[model samples]
Target: MKHCLVVDDSRVIRKVACRILGDLRFETDEAEDGAAALEICRRQMPDLILLDWNLPTMNGIEFLRALRREHEGKSPVVVFCTTENDVAHITEALGAGASEYIMKPFDREIIESKLAEVGML
Candidate 1:
């Protein structure tokens, strides 16, 4: 099964995402912040990352930049799942190497479609 890392500060969001991804047949991991997420990646990079924008430490953009600098970091498809829904935010995320972007309040259908769009489904 493919592995997925869900990085979000909110426990509820993480739980929801984990459940959805699990139903989608993905082996899942959770991280409460970007720093923690990065540590997880260092140990074992996941196939996909569901990242949040505002985190306790390192933040999403910082984590993405740092991850892209790491060996094999480019291999995992980073998908920004956040409340930041602006053209500039989207542009920056895309430029920073995110494969896709998802706004806040997402459901299984949205996640499924995004996964399919990124060829993860």
Candidate 2:
């Protein structure tokens, strides 16, 4: 099974993501924020990542950049899950190396499609 690390500050979002990923046959792990996510990344390299932009510490961009720097393209592919709907935000996240980006209030279909695009589903 593919392993996914979901990094989000909201408990509800994290639970929702975990449930969805589990339902899809993906092993799931949780991180309350970017800082915690970084620690988890160092310990276990997941196959995919569901990242959030507005985190308590470090934020998604920093975490993504850090992953690129440290893991050097071997890091798990990341998808930014966020509320930022601005085009600039999307562009920035993509430039930072996110495999995909999902806006908040999304469901299984959206995530499934994105994952499929990256050949994770």
Candidate 3:
């Protein structure tokens, strides 16, 4: 089974995403912050990462940059699941090596669609 990491400060969000990913046939892991997520990635990279924008210890963008630098181009596909809907934020995230973007308050369909866009679903 494919592995997916769900990084979010909100427990509810993590649980929801994990459930959705599980239904999509992915084995899921949860991290409450970017630092923890990075540590998990360092140990074993997941096939995909559903990341949140706001996090403690390290933010999503910072973690993305660090992950990209540390893993080169072999890093797992990262999809930013954030509330930031501005064009600039989206462009910044995409330019920072994110595979895709998913706006906040997402549901199963939206998550599935994003994953499919990234060829994960």
Candidate 4:
């Protein structure tokens, strides 16, 4: 099974993503912030990351940049899960090394479809 790291400050959101990923056959882990997520990346790199844009210590873009730089060309496929629907925000995430982007208020269908689009299913 594929491993997925879910990064979100909100516990509810993290749980939601984890459940969605679980339903899709992913072994999911949760991170409350970028710091924890980064540590987890260094320890065991997940196949995919579902990250939120708003975090306490480091935001999603910062986390993505850090992961991208540290892992070089072998980083996990990162998907930004954010409430920011602005195109510029999405572009920034992509530029920072996110593989895909999804807006917040997501249901299982959306998350499942997004993962499928990335071939995680």
Each model's lDDT: 0.94, 0.90, 0.92, 0.88
Better of 2 and 3 by TM-score: 3
- Residue pairs that clash (backbone atoms under 3 angstroms), model 2: none
The candidate with the higher TM-score, 3 or 4, is 3
Can you write out model 3's per-residue Cα lDDT over 10-118, one digit (the tens) per residue? 9999988998898889999999998999999999999999999999999999999999989878369999999988899999999999989999888889998999999
RMSD values for the candidates in order, in angstroms, are 1.0, 0.9, 0.8, 1.0
Which residue runs does candidate 1 get wrong by more than 4 Å? none
Q: Which residue pairs show collisions in model 4?
A: none
TM-score of each: 0.97, 0.96, 0.97, 0.95
Task: Sort by TM-score, best first.
Answer: 3, 1, 2, 4
- Residue-wise C-alpha lDDT for candidate 2, range 1-121, written one tens digit per residue: 8999999999999999999999999999999877888899899889999999998868989999988888876458899999998999999998988989899889999999999988887
In candidate 1 the C-alpha lDDT for residue 7 amounts to 97
Best by lDDT: 1
Model 1 agreement with the true structure over 53-112: per-residue lDDT tens digits = 999968999999999988444579999999999999999999999999999889999999
- How many residue pairs clash per model? 0, 0, 0, 0
**Candidate 4 wrongly placed segments (more than 4 Å):** none
lDDT ranking, high to low: 1, 3, 2, 4
